[model samples]
Target chain A: MPYRYLEDIATADVAFEAWGKDLGELFAEAADATTNVMVEGLASIKRKETIDIELRNPELDILLYNFLNELVYLKDARRLLLRAYDITVEKEWPDFRLKAKVSGEAIDHARHRLKADVKAVTLHRLSVRETPEGWKATVVLDI
Target chain B: MRAQLAVPESIKKISDTVWEIPASYKPGMLVPARIYATEKLLKEMDAGVFDQVTNVACLPGIVNYALCMPDGHWGYGFPIGGVAAFDAERGVISPGGIGFDINCGMRLVLTNLTYEEVKPRLHELVDSLFYRIPTGVGSTGFIKLSFSEFEELVEQGSRWCLKKGLAWPEDLELTEERGCFAGADASKVSRKAVERGFDQVGTLGSGNHYCEIQVARPENIFDGNTARAFGFTVPDQVAVMFHCGSRGFGHQVATDYLQVFLDVMERKYGIKTLDRELACAPFNSPEGQAYFAAMKCAVNMAFANRQVILHRIREVFSNVFKKSPEALGMSMAYDVTHNTAKLEDHTINGRRTRLLVHRKGSTRAFGPGMEGIPERYRETGQPVIIGGSMETGSYLMAGLSTGAGAFYSTAHGSGRTMSRHQAKRTYRGEKLKRDMEARGIYVRSDTWGGLAEEAGAAYKNIDEVVEATELAGLSKRVVRLLPIGNIKG
Candidate 1:
């Protein structure tokens, strides 16, 4: 796993740190960590529906923030449990644009072993920075 | 990673139950931060409470002090049980202080039946409730509405339920603000928020949200007169209590405004906050007024959500008992909001002034003789519901006149001590279920993992927290409720 849940960062909510060789990989890992909080088994979510999400922000951290919150929005608005893949991030002038395809089926009580329902992605201690190895992002989700 | 913070050396013991971090301790602080906790609770508090509460003091136009109730814990921008009042004209309004779950609150319903009357059918009642009320991830409510209808419903709040015959007239009177928050302009709400919340009117969102059947035993009545006034007249009188909020609609509203505030707070308003989550705009700014109007829509949506759930609860109970809801004498005790920012009148510098109060994870416990409370409860005070962990029990409290110190606010629930990950690792859901069943509490949950995360041991002792609130003169205990049946979302 490229992301790990942080124990002391939050007591009433979930916090995790995700890293990647680059921004694209880091965004995917962070998305996975968020979905994993709600569903015990991500692999159990069948790719019956695909959602194409494109978001842009001048700030890399805000770009990731909007990306994750989009997934949470889909969970409620579309009733889909998704896993993001085929992700790409590119910097266009002063803006960072993120485009990804998220695939999953409508929530099935039989197939989906659900856990906590994440309310939203928060900006609490939210950060994205490049390290020696690659890129890392810290996120705290309000559950 | 940030190092763990220790108790600040600048903190002083204000009283046996109150601790203060002087404004001089931190630059830019306009007022001190006061914490209402017993010595033990204060000692055990996570360092974030100290850091966040003090940061709140730095907000411009803050009145008196930044306050945290006994259940205060680590939260994003403000501590979970944080409370602060800002000047109506000069102060700022931040989504961080109000929380994402806009009017996330608690509601108590009284039934004439006793525990003995409902004991044999406890399992059936809980199972029926669980099946009727959607739970867990991606669950939608039974009420489906077009986007336009949703807009109107939110503007109307619980009044929509009354018009639709889903709520009793008396229920509205018992709810705070009569179930509808004024100044809710749906046009101020974003389309994304409307889409996310349109279909979730009656859902019980997961993670610490639950519908419970509890009994108020004769022995646990702390204040008999107040309990009687609040409708706890019989020995082991059964009641229904549930905790939930506005769901996704509220989250989207907060998210949208946070971004809007982030863009203008410093650039346009020149307001700097210690945390990014504390993004705010002046209350009089266009952005702030727009967000406040939108926030009230979410608040009304939450009230409608709980009202619809109560309708379903009545249906399930009446069906099981083969009696009409009216025949069963089911009536609402009260509904209280935990996360909200409201404009109200308060005393500042020994004069009555209008202040905008922000209470995140804290309930407004307006004492007796307060103007806004229902006339029936004028003498006894507003009913305050403090939900405990399922395995232990909850409490029904009443506000006190002495609550003026904290602007008539108190703790909302048994604050979590253990992290969700730690709780899951420490407790097994199956074993917990069995143990609770042995103790005569029947529980139905969507998933075992979620159940494990809510183990009673994960939270502080509810009894102790309530005692601290009482000692701090925030609220007075009325009756302790023992759970017999629960539906966990």
Candidate 2:
């Protein structure tokens, strides 16, 4: 049961489910689906660039916010459209590191378009769970 | 989904215009619950807000409505959009209503330079503005206030800025209560609030706070030919708008007073509440007076904060355009608060009693020719600013006299429709930035996670929300603004 967007408000709970041989593929699929809800052409990104991210949250919900926020930061500072290619999420000794490959073309008025500018990841109705088949997380975004 | 609410036994819908939760509803309620939202929006409200609002209704010595505004949401305890008035004689004050950011509000600036004149320099202007204004979480400020000066600021609000040469005296004319709430006793504020506030004047705190550039609509312009017609011209002219509030000092004050209220709610007055987060002391009571004094301190601090930001903006324009701020036409349009409680004379039960009106997550929209309004624009009405998220456009409105029944208030921002968690899970930061850039909204932020949390989709539609406010006769739209650039903290 890979994660999927809910019919709720932009901030409403979204369901995600995916199973991969390793953590990298699982995260990549999750990232692809997440960005897909925002715009078209996630697969169009050439995976030309890679961003290194490290985030630690007492809860998985906060971790998700950090992950998404990093993507937002890169977009604003550098006018680049990014599609997550590969992702690695690890938890050990109370520290977590998430590394991923991302790629997008430089922003051009003729190309990319804007939809929503999210403010902050909220704590409302955030959950991450493991299933027999794979993993599922339900999160509400603060659009 | 429609709003799923857990209505406490204490609450009852008296009519379409009113909702009440009795004291017996939750055992600690000093007064009944009151809400002022339309049927449609009310039906869309979050259930947690109902619990929080009822919890506030049960506070000690609250008189009149333990009110909830149209955009109410589940907050710390009193609900983000909740408002309640305590009788000056026996009412109580709680920090929960004022929120962590005291007087967190919106300010609009109209320039002599129309949008067309500034359009060519839009990129330079946004970059300069972002650099000039300090922003982000735990951000510091350029102006630092001394202990005695801080006291004056707390007591005098924006007037303090005028005295310090940071503002135009005429600017105060367009501010609420002339930018000051009287009876602010600086001595009552906690040392922690004072310490935190002393150096953070003129800084923008993080989380949904922003400075934006917008263009006004043609028909809704109030100035007509007066030159202040929202400064919109064609598509290039830019009007500056920002939303901020008292910074860390305000948060500390709210924290301090909330603790005070909780401690004495039962012991000093035998008042109890279902939620300790809704703790309060009577307005006329010693505890209430103390809280009110501290709240005013935060209010004044916010005024000074905005004043300083204005100065910084002027400096930025001068540097970027190579002209004086005056030459750049960087003058303030108006400043108004969304989260605050004040004592005003309003006709209640057909009698004009000085009732305390709490406008949490609501703006004060006084009607045309109100005595309190400044003389220059008395015919038009008080300026009302409604800020939308970065991706969406914000609006400037004018108050209508018809709003007197609701204590002259209107909605603040588009209410949150999506939670932050859902946003991060659904949207990637880089992708969102690309989309925003394509729309011509240049954004500068510190954290990607923070940016994702504030995606514009998280909020209700601004146009719909503003229309609802008008339909409810809360405020009349004057000008609509589309964002060209933004700086978020």
DockQ, each predicted model: 0.87, 0.07
Cα-based TM-score, every candidate: 0.99, 0.74
- The candidate that wins on DockQ is 1
Judging by TM-score against the true structure, name the best candidate: 1
Screening candidate 1 with a backbone cut-off below 3 angstroms (N, C-alpha, C), the clashing residue pairs are: none
How do the residues B1-489 of candidate 2 rate in per-residue lDDT, one tens digit apiece? Answer: 456454444456665645566666555556666666666666677776776776777665566556676666666556777776655565666666766667989888766565666667878888888778877633467876686888778898888889889888777876777888888899998775676667678877666788887766565454453335433444334578888888766766776676577668899888766655567777878888888888988888898888888888878777767888787766677899987888877776777777677777778888878878777657777778899888888888878888765678777888787776677777877788779988877777655655776788888778777776777677877677888777777
A24-115: candidate 1 lDDT, tens digit per residue: 99999999999999998888989999889998999999999999999998888888888888999999978998889989888888888888
* lDDT tens digits, residue span B1-489, model 1: 221345678889999899999999888889999999998888878889999999999998899999999999988788999999999999999999999999999999999999999999999999999999998888899987999999999999999999999999999999999999999999999998998899999999999999999999999999999999999988989999999999999999999999999999999999999999889999999999999999999999999999999999999999999999888879999999999999999998889989999999999999999999999999998999999999999999999999998999999999999988999899988998999999999999998878998999999999999999999999999999999999998
lDDT of each: 0.94, 0.69
What is the DockQ score of candidate 1, to 2 decimals? 0.87
- The list of candidate 1 runs beyond 4 A from truth reads B1-5
Clashes of each: 0, 54
